[model samples]
Target: MYPSSALGEFLRSRRARLQPEELGLPGGVRRRRVAGLRREELAPLAGVSVGYYIRLEQGQAPNVSDEVLDALARTLRLDADERRHLHRLARIPQAQTSLPPTEVLRPGLSHMVEAFTDAPAIAVGRRGDILAWNPLAHALLAPHWPVMPTGRPPNFVRIDFLELAFARSLYADWAAKARDDVAYLQVSVSNFPGDEQLLAFIAELKELSPEFRELWAEHPVSNCATIAREYRHPQVGAMTLAAELLRPPDDEGQGVTVFQAEPGSVSQDRLRRLAELTSGSAA
Candidate 1:
């Protein structure tokens, strides 16, 4: 079966996440069979006709003006990234998603990643495939895998959901990480609406993992470029690192994520120990 239209699904999910009471709607939040503001309620608040809003939500409205979308965004109380996503869904033409032919990290970027010898760094492709990583990154992220991966590469989504034992053991807050992964995937889907392959990727994940299925249905969208992550390394104990996702100016589809701890902090010391331990083990 075909997936629901991304535009329509996104709108419905956003609407369902909001509550009448939160928006200070009249009638004092009576119990209802349906959740969130109904089309009739939302339309007036967004300064559009109920029928028109319904049409937009159903993906029937075409060439919708930015002013109207902005009104909808404001009324929905969408965050900056979400507002941008809504605009893209309303205004951009449908196109198939295309990724680079090679999964190899760019030469310059790979060098940069390696230059972060003290910190953990990884390069990933658009679809979450791990392209390259430094030794510390290898030890920190996926010690279960080879130093240089062969055959199938490690993936962010697969590693987080499919490798439950490892993920649960590794992250201090596995639930938060799951949300981040699913939301980032939504960002990818929104970037390329009507992409069958991307839809299939979602379908496969849903089929395999109930948690992923539930989160995917929630339709959360986030573009987290930097986040403080807590890692419970089996070898070196607990540490917190700021993971910064950097995309090259020339390439939007690939990113280098560097993990570094605050100077003079306990986490920084643990990270150093991890680097030494991993290197010694390899030696």
Candidate 2:
């Protein structure tokens, strides 16, 4: 389902976003009947026939080649992530069968999370579940986590975009961040066509939020590495935190996103003090 229908949807989404004028085509010649670029127009741009593009979108075509996929991605102005997704969909030699359900975090990973004292670290599964976190992680991400206890593994994607109050209070640039996170998740989902939770999550998000629906239609892949996020903390007031993501070699889905402040800065000092006050309080 992922590498098959998802590719079609992804391509269609990209085509729907651009205007004739944006693509340097005549805009006022005739009243457009459709919502997005026409198949004929896109076919030429992608160096394919109208019938071929139509077949690809309709999932009637055979496996797409890398060269053709790259051309389509370039024509659609895809980013690094989007391009990779295009390749992924094209290169999946075997037809998609049924995918497995989500896997819960292991106990050893939970113990590792519990051992972290000052660092705000959490073990997130492939689908972005909270999985496990130390007290400091809970304290720092409390704004995003809501009242759901650590064991329940609250999903950050759902919390940020769906829960209006939590999103507005926790992140000033909520929409941008949410879109990035969504795109990231989409890329991950595309990578793992055998992930059932990924498919279900995409379906649910598409149904629930109009903004998410619109953005999902674009099919942009979110692969931006570094971002400075502004957090309006209840205790520390307002501070911009720079986040760095570290991926473990053994686990493809697991990664540690560590937050830090600028050197010799008050925010840094405050974070250090906060760590001192609350570090290693096992409860």
Candidate 3:
């Protein structure tokens, strides 16, 4: 979808989730063709002309003022992240949709990922594609799929959705993790609105997984960083791993994320065992 299309879709979806009664309107779902407030109701509340608001929703409005956007954001109950997404879709210049070259692993970062023997560390490209990973990360995240000699890299979003059985076995809260995967993609797209390759990738995944389609339509917004990953590891039983996301100053939509088990915790012990198993096999 184009940036305007994304903008329109986002506005429509957010409005659909709200009820007229919630805003102290008299209708109470009366005379309402849809579930949410109508354009007329929203326009007046946000201090804009009804025609202008309609144009904005349809992506026909060439320009929108920040004051208006702020009002609309407030009316729609948008969070900080969602508000940022709204602004970008409305104002930021669109990046070229042509597929860029394959993402290369930066030198020091690849070494950095490999250096983390005690924890799961990975170099993550856009949309959570695995660029480089240490042995523990390999064992922790995608043990079933052996590392490819050469091909498209393994993407965590695709794995989290299409590989349902494995994901469920890995994450204690599989449903939340699946939703988070979708949301991360949503946030990433704000950087390259209407990117053909990225859009096609997401569209294909949505087609492949019904669960993904359901979550994608919700338009959840979040970055890839996770506070904790509650793992139900088949080998080590259970582990609650904390994450630290590393984005360099010259970030090009790539970063390193490490998952660590707290020192002296049972999770740390299990992680050590997992590490031994992964490294010993390699040796």
Candidate 4:
């Protein structure tokens, strides 16, 4: 979808989720044809004209002021991330810059991953490509696939959506994870519109996976930094771990994701067991 349409859809979706009563507005005696606050009802509350609000929601408003955007965000009760996304969508001069090529993990980053002997750590590029990963991460995320050399990268998006059986076996909530991946991709595409590799990757995914096509149409945008993910491992059974995403300084679009379990928990015990199994297999 175009950025303007995305902005409109996001506004409509958020507006539809709020109730008149929740906004401290009296529910009128008249029967409502649509859900949530009407444009006229919301306009006054946001200190904007009904005509202007309608134009904004219809993606026809040009050069929307930051004051108006912030007012709308507050009126809609948007969370921090959602508010940022709204600003990105509504801002004028939506400049598109070509992103740099994928980066390999620096030596210090490789060392950092190695230090996490008990945790699974991987370095990922902008387009969800696995740039470098520690042995534990390899065992956790892709034991079947060989770890490639520095220049070549393995992509998480392809493996998750295109390889259904593997993805279903790996993630306990495969559908949710898949949707998150697609949503992240959508946000990435919006941010880096001039990235040819990203465009090609998305085109390839859309052509290959009908499921991806359906999810992409929903226009979900998210930048999830931490997630509680469940993995069904052949050696360690079911384990729930918190995946933390860390972007290294000056790494551009690359990020280091580390998965860890609570100390002294059953998940931790499983992780330790998995580490031992991976070590033994390597030996």
Candidate 5:
């Protein structure tokens, strides 16, 4: 079929938002019957025939040309992210027979995590899969989990949005923080086109929340080098933490993210106390 379910949904979403009147076409002087502009209307707007547009929409078009895709993008007035998504869906190659696990932490990177003894540090792949995390990192991040799973990868993006108590309780600047996190993840997705896992994760998020779909369409980018975050520590109360993202040497495919509270501040005090409470809990 088409690369994934996301393609049909993406096109339909765009098509459902346009109007013939908006395209400078006659509104037929009669009431419109369709929810959005019909395929025939879009074909003329995109400078393509209705039959061809129908084939494209129905997932029957094979090896769709970039020029035609660009024409459709222009006609739809797609934003940068939506245009990129269109291109991605149309061009995603077949999955490899033996695709390797994208998450793997290097030794030197592991050492860096250890070096940040007091800071909460985590190593994540391009797809946001947590490959490794330091002790304090676990303490800063894991309070959200109802029960910590043994030796399993935790998806940071999923926990942020899906976990009700965690998003509401732990994160203080929740909306802004969520947007930044999603923007960062989008950048990673853009960097690695045709990564099946990344594509599937984006598809999953798109289905899970309309807000995410809207944000993803905006195509924001965040480097994650530094961020201001507020965390409510069950033990020490609320603390604002400065998040840091570190990319190791070229050989390492993963990046390390550390959250540190300002020294001598209330957040610092809370982080220290919380760290003490979970001292030996790291598995």
Candidate 6:
């Protein structure tokens, strides 16, 4: 994908969400044609000419200065992550190397997951593929799905958005979770624009799921670190868990995710029972 196109889309999406009155601009009595601040209105507030802003929005502006980018970022109320993404898109190189290779869990990392008998911990690759998981995590996340062979990884995005019916049943707030997954994928794309496999996965999702396509078009980006998720496990009934995402020190795109419940809470009790059940079955 062209960086210019990505930058333009991101800018336009951000602009469309801001109301004119939010920036202290007067809302005229006449109905506005566009949803948010018009291009003309945004240009002056961002300290740039209307023609230049138009060119920038149309992906025709070249050699955009830092001052102008910062001005536009401020005008659009971009957060730190969004600002970084903006910079990455605007400073694209003519040639980009392929994404780094898929990460495998170190022996120590694998042992760590084995040690977490009660909690659910899993390692995932950049493309949302499950790299490694303990029995508890496997039981919690994909009890009903068929297991892939040893070297092959199961993609969470495909299961959640396209093929698996159990995914809808797994998450209590399916829509919100689905959107977060898409947004996370969006951020990953900005980081690795040259990954053909990643691009193909995105294309397949767009063709398979209308919801995924709609969410992808919004250009939402995030680095999800902590989240409270509710899951309705087939064996455990209902439980709310806190998910913590950790990137290994040596790995850039791979992450280790752990799920836990409050001590002595009902959810924790349920988790204990679920773990026992999985352990018993494994033996």
**What lDDT tens digits, residue by residue, belong to model 1 across residues 197-266?**
5567778899999999999888788886989989999988999999999988876567899999999999
Residue 116, candidate 5: C-alpha displacement in angstroms: 2.4
Per-residue alpha-carbon lDDT of candidate 5 for residues 226-259, written as tens digits (9 for 90 to 100): 8887787666788898888888657233788888
Off by over 4 Å in 3: 27-31, 92-101
lDDT of 6 by residue, 1-283 (tens): 6454888888888988999899999988998877888898899999999999989877787688888999999999999878888887777664778864554656766676677777999877677888778888889988755444455577778879876478889999998888888877877777777776777788889999998999988888777788899999888889999989888777556777899998989999999999989889988
lDDT of 5 at 161: 69
At residue 168, what lDDT does model 6 achieve?
A: 88
Error of 3 at 155 (Å): 0.5
Q: Give the TM-score ranking, best first.
A: 1, 3, 6, 2, 4, 5
Candidate 6 ranges with C-alpha deviation above 4 Å: 29-31, 100-112, 147-152
lDDT of 1 at 227: 93
Task: Please say which candidate is ahead in TM-score: 4 or 6.
Answer: 6
In candidate 4, which residue pairs clash? Answer: none
Clashes of each: 0, 0, 0, 0, 1, 0
Assess the local accuracy of residue 130 in candidate 5 as a C-alpha lDDT between 0 and 100: 73
Per-prediction TM-score to the true structure, in the order listed: 0.92, 0.84, 0.92, 0.83, 0.63, 0.90
- Badly placed stretches (over 4 Å) of model 2 are 1-3, 92-94, 97-118, 143-151, 208-211, 249-251, 280-283
TM-score of 4: 0.83
Model-by-model lDDT, in order? 0.82, 0.72, 0.82, 0.82, 0.72, 0.82
lDDT of 1 at 262: 97
